[model samples]
Target chain A: MASTMLRTSALRSTIRATPTVASKRARLAGVSFVRGKATLPDLPYDYGALEPAINGKIMELHHSKHHNTYVTSYNQAIEKLQEAQQAQDIAGQIALKPLINFHGGGHINHTLFWENLAPKNQGGGEPPSGSLSKAIDGSFGSLDAMKQKFNTALAGIQGSGWAWLVQDTQTGSISIKTYANQDPVVGQFRPILGIDAWEHAYYLQYQNRKAEYFSAVWDVVNWKAAEKRFK
Target chain B: MACNLTPLISPQALEPHISAQIMTLHHTKHHQTYITNLNAALGKLSTAVSTSDITTQVALQPAIRFNAGGHINHSLFWLNLSPPSSPDAKSSAAPQLTSAINKKWGDMETFKSAFNTQLLGIQGSGWGWLVKEEGKNDLRIMTTKDQDPVVEAGLVPVFGVDMWEHAYYLQYNNVKADYVKEIWSVINWKVAEERFLGAQKNAFGMLKASM
Candidate 1:
């Protein structure tokens, strides 16, 4: 009798899920992003700020052309996803995950990338102070050693990717990780610093010499910003 | 069983063609996540299967299929690729593989042309595969949606390429064609030949057993 009862209820539950799923999709279709459309984030400093290390032309192109494209595409993809959900197009919703990850990741990474640098005069080259200092020394032996480790990772990227220094939010553990293309340091890691190894970043000034670019980038790294994230 | 992350082809090793940044990031981060996530999902699936939790099993379908396939596909993908046309992977190195490809697609250029076109047409994250079907000598070109391993379709994957934007977006940028075109330079044909030979034994053995 209990088995029969469970079977009947299971059948009913399966049937009920259809309309419930459809209505939920309808609700999602009408929804907008919590913050409205994603917009292009302004760089905290001017394109020319990083100067010889990054160069103004590369920064300008990266900001205007690349970052903005992600913002525009992300808006379009989300809107389409909403429409697909409203119409109960399950396949369409499934198809949009790549778009959401790619464009959304592009927007997120670039926003973080822009702020992680500063003009050398604005404490760009300065090492972390306070708890961040202690953490760095403990985690990576010393700051200079960490820089070497970080640069080696960045220099070895096989394609377009970023090297990140991240702090795991839960364990408070720090690690150096590399991500392909615009994929942000995902899941539990809180990004402290990222070095964009995309060719467009250093192609104009450094060309094929990524090692030189990595070496030069130290001069404009904003340890102050990284320290804030570390905490 | 848990799928482990495959070790990477070093940046210095694949230099001059594929950048150190692209290769390192793709293997270490991208491929590693798929394996990690697959193991996690499979753990949950084990519990669900033991209890005969149909609802839970249904809910876990996408995660299992996507991640499991990702692990399988990427593992083969890494071996199937090496610094293209290098001595180990030279076009002439594998006589049997060359003859098989020629028999199916007429010639090498035609096969590549057709393969890249099929790969480019995938609407989103997917894989283009050259598969040798079980018990069949002739191969087929197929596409699997988002980490769907070709093995699930009763075929043995010979050559597989990830069409995800991250695969080429760094080096080729918006020009996916160039990335697809250049990838041929680093393909490990030697591995494909070995996979082909091994798969033949499996296919024929299954046939003999059934008969």
Candidate 2:
């Protein structure tokens, strides 16, 4: 009986959140983000703040353009997904998932991507302090050791993916993990830091050399921001 | 990459007791097909993302969810079996993984029996898993249907057993029970231990543990 109630509640939430095509389409035609739709987060600093490390052109493209595309597509997918559900189009909903995963992942990744970065002028590139720094030493032996291990793991990515510093649920210490494409760190592992390894992330400045990009991103890592996140 | 089809182990290691031909065909043919299928599924997922044709909810999600599950499950299945690492040893003993399992699940015999019993009870194609779940930091047993990962269940996978037919067909044919019994001989406890200790560390900092 309890399970049935839970299932009914789930079904109710699903129905309540069902998309209205009229509103969804109306919101999409506009350039601005809609409330309850996808909203473009405000940049903490000017677009050119993280110059040289992540250049103005890359930031402009990554944010105003690329992230916007994901936001638009995600809203559209959700709208269609709701319609499909309402119509009992099981086959249609099944088909729409990649868009949701990709675009939804795009939104998720970019949201973190923006906050994770900061200008070196504003204390970026600094290493973690306090318990985080100590934990880093304990797990990987030293800060440099952790960086080397992370770089090796990042460079080892065969294709487009993400390199992450994630909290292990059981151990409660940070560990470096890599995921191919947009596979999220997911579940209980809290993301302390993440570096995007997608070609678009560093293609303009570094060209094809991922290792160089991996090395360079360290300069604008926003360690102060990372330290704040650990708590 | 393509599954290393030629041969990974010597046939003579499991000989007389377990035939060389059976091991060869099982690893090279059956497991290889799963790898190929998994790759194909991933490729389809990529295509869906690129094309943007997935305008509905039902179209591409199932492919990504199901095929990714298939890939992960099959990959683990192939890694589960082996010939006894030493001649004098009990074929089923996995020295590397046993101590950790003992630490968590009481003792080797108990853990093995429980795991195999769960494996025997699976209603259909699914997996039997030993996962480490966090909450005071401990290992736990979890079973999942189809190809769903323990990670999705919010646990770190310590050990896994795939009950899918392709895993057992070449050797035991229709008799899954015999195949499950046979696989215990070659369990790689070493890799399992590494994963265990790694999970034991406050990895990625989400848990409340001291370094």
Candidate 3:
């Protein structure tokens, strides 16, 4: 009975969120039920700010072209999903799930990625000083050790993916995890920092020597941002 | 079977079109890792089969498909390229395949334009292939996402272009159109012709030979 009620409410919310239905209801009641659209988040610093570690051209393309594509694709997927829901097309809705997950995850991951970096002069690469530092020390013995493990995890990724430093929400234990493609870190884990392992991330500057790119990225990692997420 | 197949053409042979640095790393590091993972997955699969572990067997399907497809695709990719200086690089080297392509798209230029459109249309990691349809002379352009090989019965993959960022990012950066344009110069038409005219088994015989 509880599950049935929960399922019915979920279906009710879906119908309420449909634009055509919502707009008609809005005209009657003067209340809007439309959800806000996802948009590309602005980067915290100038494109060239991370220079030498990551080039301005790579940064520009990564944000404007790559991340923007994800934003646009995710929005399109959401629109199609709404149309499918309105048509009561179960197969169409099922097929759109992966697209929504991939593009949506891409947007979410890249937004966090932009925040997880900073220019060298702006407190980037500085070791965490607060409880986050203690947590890292407790988990991996030292900052350097944790970084080494993180880099190793990044290296082991088979294809396009991300390596994340996450804290288990239940246990508050920090560890390294890798995800394939654009899968977001979810369910019991809080993502503190993420490093994109896709070739587009460093291929321009590092070429095939990805280990160099991996090591260089640490020089610009925004520990303060990570610390904020940790708390 | 051990995954020890070597490229028919030397790594540096495709330079200018594709740099030696990219080729060497693509072959040595990236493709090698796929081979290693495929072997490991096969070993685990054998164990699961022997132990009758249906759950483990089911779990291993994706790894097996991904790694095996990677090996197959890379193997075909290497053979599908030729040095620009080689006679095999010329479209004239593939009379039968060229006629088929001309039949399908009206001319070579139109065919390549259509193929490039499909190549660039791929989002994220993938491959664009020119495949010969089942039991017919009909040809089609198709794109497969992330290491997926063309393995449908009777459809022969004449050749494929890797559209992964690693395939061109070092040289072309985000200008993928340039990479797609340049790759035509090094395409091994001779190998493609053979795959087009030959049986499906012949197209995959390289895998059997390696085994």
Candidate 4:
């Protein structure tokens, strides 16, 4: 059933611009909107897109397994939350909030992270452009300084967390911060660049030497997505 | 005043929008029901039931969690609410909580807008909360149904608006959403900041307490 949906979605992509009016309407509303939930998106590029910097094995585990776990948990939590809310079981609803945060966060962050990488030799490395470049320069002095600061902060993570280059909403200035576990940056900042520092993120590749993994991540840093976030 | 809890709203203070009679009944009768239910649930637990099994303990967690939650939530609600303030109180000097809201949300109005947006999304009996995400000091919206404590979600709830039927059923009847929309006028931002600061200081300890 899942593969059938994927096939039809792929077919819809191929016949773009000249789609049937009915299909276009369905597409505009989202095919999954009919069911009220969407399946996990397929990775845009191959698992090997970020090879060496992030091994194929890590990408495979991260996407197929870790991300899937979050997706499953998020769906289950949503169902439970809906049930609790319907019963006016405030206690039950409150009890399920952590599952929502942990699983919902996992779904959100990993979805962003997947699009934020590409093959090392592809359009991944290069400096950011336009206003994003200027913003980085304005906030952190230079691109290299921003990179060094982000890496340094990420490397210093005490335990499982994410190091992020985020935009401060009040000042409209870019800043870097880290979140313990799966907590998103929430209201104070909009995340522009994030590095997954969880042990599962890089333990197999770099072992205890997180610094090495942090250094390698720069090779495939998705500057384009970060640039879009700035604009 | 009826329950002997300190009420920030006096009888004369709520004269215009909410009659003193209703306020008295709400505080004395409706709020007491939640507290009574919670205590009854706690009192019924046998010693063996309390110590027997971890799964049983986790399962029974919600009775205490919710009733206590409802009591604490309603207590805050009574303190937060007031009759539509006269222009004098509305335009009074900005309090510390307004400044804190500025730090988190840019301004009081923006914060209220966001808070109301979240509150309206509470589909059934639950609460809309403005909480400081632990360690990050960021303001975020969280909805908890029934009696879930704000901290259980790993966010330190700074302020909460209860949307349970009992909270507004007498006044608003079936229109819970309208009640939620209207309640913003009476929010006591000063108290919210006090809660926020308190939560920030003790968040790490709270996390450890759960362990």
- Which candidate number maximizes lDDT? 3
Candidate 1 lDDT, B1-211, residue by residue in tens: 5555646656656655577877777787777777777778878889999999989988988777777677677777777778753775576766787899999889999999999999876644578888786657678889986677776545777778888656665676656688788778877877777766666344223222221
Backbone clash numbers for all candidates listed: 14, 30, 0, 4
Clashing residue pairs in candidate 3 (N, C-alpha, C atoms within 3 angstroms): none
Candidate ordering by lDDT (highest first): 3, 1, 4, 2
| Whole-structure CA lDDT of model 2 | 0.64
lDDT of 4 by residue, B56-164 (tens): 5566566667666666666656644545664322413235556666887898778778887777555334678777766555677778865566646456666677765
Candidate closer to the true structure by lDDT (higher is better), 1 or 4: 1
Best by TM-score: 3
TM-score of each: 0.52, 0.46, 0.73, 0.46
**In candidate 2, which residue ranges exceed 4 Å CA deviation?**
A1-35, B1-211
Q: Report the lDDT tens digits of candidate 4 across residue range A132-196.
A: 89988988999999889989888655335688888888888888898766777779788888889
Candidate 2's displacement at residue A217, Å, is: 0.9
DockQ, each predicted model? 0.03, 0.01, 0.33, 0.01
When only the first chain is scored, the TM-scores of the models are 0.84, 0.81, 0.86, 0.83
* Candidate 4 backbone overlaps, count: 4
* Candidate 2 chain A: 10-residue stretch with minimal lDDT: A8-17
Quote the lDDT for B151 in model 1: 65
| Per-model CA lDDT versus the true structure | 0.74, 0.64, 0.85, 0.65
